[model samples]
Target: MRLEHDLAVRREARDIIADDVAIGVGDGWQHLVGRALVTIRDVTDGKVNARQIKERQGLLSIFTDIMIRGSETIAQRVFDVTNGAADQSAWVCEMCGCGGRLIAGNRLRVRCQVCEADEPERERVWREHRDDILEAAATYIRVCLEHSRLFPVYNIVIRVCLDDRDHRLFLDEVHDRLVWWRAGSWIEGVEDALRQDFRRLDFAR
Candidate 1:
């Protein structure tokens, strides 16, 4: 979340928010969170304890452990209010605070039509196990470099590894990073720089 939004919510709901409570969601849900916290405070009569507020799998996840002095009915009310807020966030864009839906991509995210339209294409394979694929690619590059020379030969080997799915995912991520940063080729070092970062590859046989 933006610092201003976070601080605003904290200020508005200071009566309910405990010192250690964490708010770790995006800006789009700021209104929802703020409103919910206020409602919770009102319903619980300023006797609630919030543990955490974060995003999980493109949805809001709020944890508020009610105080011991709180009544069972009030606790249930807090649960209902917080859960309702979380449910509401499912349709709220995490970026621009517009109506959004869960989008399937390299990562699951709630994005409005405009933001979704602006996103780059990502394959289903990239969505599932993307981190693992990138790790495998890194290990492969490290391994290839260790087994082979570092000049034109390493480049040829890395290019050939592109025929494998994992390596291609890594390349796709590299391209995506380039686009994200609006980087020109020379500003970011060449592919060799990427290869040089890898020290070794493990062949699990």
Candidate 2:
């Protein structure tokens, strides 16, 4: 298989395993075992039978081991799988509420700290530069669309207060331009985004 194909398969497998781990965590081990059996049957096209339970048991054990080693590993694997698929990480400042490198030097402060300290002055400047707020909103939308594979879009829409019509429009626009070109297929990224709940891929929200 090609590298992309392999990565895609890994991503799918990881997602499936993650779901199983979640079920196992939420319900009981017996429920996990039952779900595993169902999953094996589904994956194997009903070829898995009573005799295969032992093998499935072993598979489950290995999966649990890998999962227990680190939860973040699975998360990072998903991140790696979707890396470079979108531009999602860029962010504006919180304290100063400025875009493009709000902090300077080693201080890591949002503002220069030398200027705009007074509350009234800060509010006045922010109000005068309302365009910056709009720009930030646009950038936020762009990032949300770009990194949507990391979370589900439905959740994102809810979290971001985007209406269904606007959400679909955003998806269609991104699908037509950036997503299609990058994935070499219109549906792959869209489908993945839908499957992953449109998690933002660029950066943690």
Candidate 3:
């Protein structure tokens, strides 16, 4: 699938992504949430099933959240999946089949650190993920995001892979939020911000 930086291009590209997306519609892009989102869906039921538990019932703000921070490779893959129909992402950069990062600039996109670094940074965008590694490393999956009408919009669902870190979630530099996250909606603004980030991909632009 083609991922573009131009808002018009992205607008047209949705038709292509929607062709593959099972649900279609921007909000209907549930399949893109990936395994992480799936885990969240399974756990919270996205309120579709029933309210069982939450990290908090309120909100907590993290100074920073570069989608799985400290790990550029995973971030790039997430970008590829969301922006490019990169089904084969497999926790690896879908472009070079190596590792990379998600660049948030004029447009949300991903590229290899080795090859695409020289590319001009056009269109205000956001990009992260540095450190260099040779071979593929272990996967570091983060919270699964859900598309819900709930004010928070993006409901985070974390899955424990044998290590669910013992049903706990550790953040980048924000270690304190971890406690607030598992407690319940730590605060509404937090989710609202997250949803805003997720919403970046939902428009014609």
lDDT of each: 0.61, 0.31, 0.27
* Ranking of candidates on lDDT, top first: 1, 2, 3
Write one digit per residue (lDDT tens) for candidate 1, span 1-205.
5334555687789897753455766668889888999998899887776777878888888777684657889888888997898789888997668999998777788989975764443354466546544453444444455665222212332342334554444454433332222111222223545432321222232
Question: What C-alpha lDDT, on a 0 to 100 scale, does residue 159 get in candidate 1?
Answer: 45
TM-score of 2: 0.19
Global lDDT for candidate 3?
0.27
Q: Which regions of candidate 3 are displaced past 4 Å?
A: 2-32, 49-97, 104-108, 113-205
Number of backbone clashes in candidate 2:
13
Identify the superior model by TM-score, candidate 2 or candidate 3: 3
Give the TM-score comparing model 1 with the true structure, all chains together: 0.54
Query: Could you say which candidate leads in TM-score?
Result: 1
Whole-model lDDT, candidate 1? 0.61
lDDT minimum window of 10 residues, candidate 2: 19-28
List where candidate 1 sits over 4 angstroms from the true fold.
Answer: 67-69, 117-205
